[model samples]
Target: MKIEEVRQHVTTPLTAPAFAPVVPRFTDREYLNIVYRTDADALRAVVPEPLQVEEPLVRFEVMKMGDVSGYGPYTESGQAIEVSFDGERGEYLHAMYLDNFPATASGREVSAYPKTAGSPKLYVDNGVLVGTLDYGTLRVATATMGYKHHALDVREAERQITVPTFMLKTIPGYDGAPRVQELVRTEITDVVVKEAYTAPARLQLFQHVLAPLADLPVLEVVSASHIRTDLTLAPVKPVFDYLKGVRS
Candidate 1:
């Protein structure tokens, strides 16, 4: 897909803050990636299978300059991809990783997918890990989406699942280390039926696939900003402001 074409699909919110220039910027930085993640089961029921999952467990980084913040690419230790599964859950999993490549006088590119005239899409089977790019479009601009699904989709999962919360663990250090990294968790906050679906909706949650983090605290970054994976998790208070706050 063309980079400009995808940008046309979603609109940014007007109220969000603007990007500020980076302090002690990595002026020679290579490229940037913008990543967004939500639960799969809820997403599966809503979006058609093809786009039901917005890429898989790839690393997407957050960007920031000053007061404003947004999405960006990971400097190391991360990749991002779009993925989905059958309506029934049976451990069918898929993942994708993309490298960060900035736009040049010629064009922009993605790490795994090949470059097109401007923007490129995923090459599901046999995607290379290096030196490939797609002509990406549009620099990060401020905006929003309508009827956002920020809240986890719950109510509908009732009867299908019986647990209030569950946890996930990530492979520690990419080695057979004994580290127990945690991911998705579910909490039964409420049960409500969605207007789009007639059946009862359950709200089980998928946790932060990408670490809930900020390179700069109390600040928002722009899309394609670079973040360091080796970097420690940003500090958080008990308040637990998960999305754009200090990590608790």
Candidate 2:
């Protein structure tokens, strides 16, 4: 392709890109979020600067995406630390693991999601909502909750979904140096909460070298929410630059 055509491309592999540039809209997106308290020092070690841990809280989430604009359907599970940036409460996404390749590729390449390939499943099993994540043949995380035991306020569930999200986006230079290092922020929008509920939940994290979610160590289960919504994933904008020490 010509240089002009190359400039128009949004991602690599001009012949057949891994994912399209369409903004993904998730329909019937189901989420099981378990917020728990962890060690304060563990939170500090993983959460980067400019984001402060207020109460040593972490949210473990399992998302079952029904229909997506570009990615079709996939199940994703990850952990986010409850943090504050600029005095505003938000979540700093630590890692995301999913089963879809295109979604994983596009999420990491075009957006700030720390995406990786893994086996994650979310389903109802024997009258309980279960979410599990496995790296290779080893189980990394498992969460179980009562299936929609009590109704939750739609506005509160919306707030949980719309909370500002922060992530560190890093790109390495060709010469083995830092090229792009940014703290990006984004939030979900245009949400239509179909249903939401609260339930008793329990989580277990196993040790794995690559997926070290157990490092946080769940101390106490603060709360849990099961929300089903139709929403859009908003684009990310760099709020702070680690290399330059200012907004990029």
Estimate TM-scores for all models.
0.17, 0.98
- The positional error of residue 12 in candidate 1, measured at the CA in angstroms, is 30
Q: Let me know the TM-score candidate 2 reaches against the reference structure.
A: 0.98
- The C-alpha stretches of model 1 lying farther than 4 A from their native spots are 1-68, 72-93, 101-168, 171-175, 181-183, 186-248
Task: Return the top candidate by TM-score.
Answer: 2
List model 1 lDDT by residue over 1-248, tens digit each: 58775564322232331222221122212212333344445335433222234432222321211211222432222223333322322111122222332211011111111111222122112322121222134221111212222332334223222222222223344577634332222222232222211111111112232322221111221222211111111211122122333322
Write one digit per residue (lDDT tens) for candidate 2, span 106-207.
888888899998899999998799999999999999999999899999999999989999999999999989899999999999999999999999999999
Per-prediction CA RMSD (Å): 20.4, 0.8
Q: Report the error of model 1 at residue 74, Å.
A: 11
Q: Rate the local accuracy (lDDT) of all candidates.
A: 0.25, 0.94
The total number of steric clashes, by the backbone 3 Å criterion, in model 1 comes to 43
